[model samples]
Target: MIKLVIIGSGNVAQHLIQAFAKSKEIKVSQVFSRQKETIIPLLDSSKITTNFNDLIEADIYIIAVSDDAISKVSSQLPFENRLVVHTSGSVPIESLDNKNKRGIFYPLQTFTKGKDVDFSLIPICLESENDSDFDLLEKVAKTISNNVFKSNEKQRKALHISAVFVNNFVNEMYRIGNEICEENKVPFEILKPLILETVNKVMTLSPKEAQTGPAKRNDMQTIEAHLDFLSNKNHATIYKILTQSIQNNGKEL
Candidate 1:
């Protein structure tokens, strides 16, 4: 079995614990967290501790901490020359302490609190300084997920940026849709099927090919009607800008 030690108590760490729970090949031997109470609900008291000095011997030490704290956390490890990895998309493997072997095991997905995610669907992006270390990382990753990709820091950062545009920015657009619905006393649930269908269409079609709306058709009359209907200046400005963008295909919108 591949023994593992996880450091952190946040959504990523907690989710990892749950994913590894059913794995026969990988065992989470111990989890270190300053806020031990926060992780105790997921792991037993025997396997969770606040002291880094009390860390158990493991094949891999997974630091699932924040990006800023990754270097600091790796530097604080009492042992050296161990295979240590961090779960960060943007942070490079060089950010780890040189005392030990460094690698990255970034799971490309937004982990929300109190929500269980299907780890099998998550894309596990792996990077390491050595081929041997990468093999170990990939082995662990495959136990929970089949979608594993070998990515360097630059590629990982690009993926993260694209994810932000597609996931985070798209969510903001949904929020704006909700606000517009509320302002007009329209039921937001009524739009859920349309939203789902739009998503389904994009699965088999390019976003540009799937695009359909007054903006895509360059219907200026309908665009102006939408702008005039929106009372919020911010919403109107955003609508006009986006409509122009769609019509111009990103040319001088």
Candidate 2:
């Protein structure tokens, strides 16, 4: 069995704990956090430690802490022989000291505490300092996900940027739409089907091919009407930029 110690107690930590618990090859030997309150009710009665030196011996230590805390927490670890990994997408694995084996086990999916995660469907990005470490990382990743990729630090960084665009920015757009609906007395639920369909279409069609709107057709009249409707400065700016982009791409409305 692969003994694993998890560090952190946030959303990502909760998701990983449940996923690892379901795996037959991996066993969570301990959980480490600075505050006991942060980890209570989420972690089982396995070895829990607040002192970094008191952390139990494990073959692998998975750091699921905040992006800002990774390097600091990693530098304080007691063991040098065990493999250490972080789950941050933007943070490079090399930030950790090179004295021991270091790797990244990033899951390319948003995590919410108490929310169910379909681990089999999520893609796992695996990277390591050397071939042996990479092999071990891949083995551990394959247990949780069928879609695993050997991504280096640079590629992972680029992928993270894309995620911010496709996930974070897209969610912001949805929020703007909801706000607009509320201001106009339009029920936001009216757009739910359209939103779902838009995402579903992209699964079978390229985003450019799935493009359908007045902007895609270069319908200046409709575009102008939309701008007029969106009086909010930020929303209007976003609309104008996207309209110009769609027209530039020559995508049919």
TM-score of each: 0.95, 0.95
The list of candidate 1 runs beyond 4 A from truth reads 250-253
The clash numbers for all candidates, in the given order, read 0, 0
How close to the true structure is residue 139 of candidate 2, measured as C-alpha lDDT? 89
Supply candidate 1's per-residue lDDT for 80.
Answer: 93
Per-residue lDDT of candidate 1, residues 1-253 (tens digit): 9999999999999999999998999999999999988988888899988898999899999999999999999999999999999999888899999999999999999998799899999999999999999999999999999899999889999999999988998898899999999988999999999989999998999998999999998888888888888999988888888787788885763
Alpha-carbon lDDT, every model: 0.93, 0.88
lDDT by residue (167-188, candidate 2, tens digit) is 9999999999999999999999
Q: Point to the candidate with the largest lDDT.
A: 1
Residue 187: error of model 2 in Å? 0.7
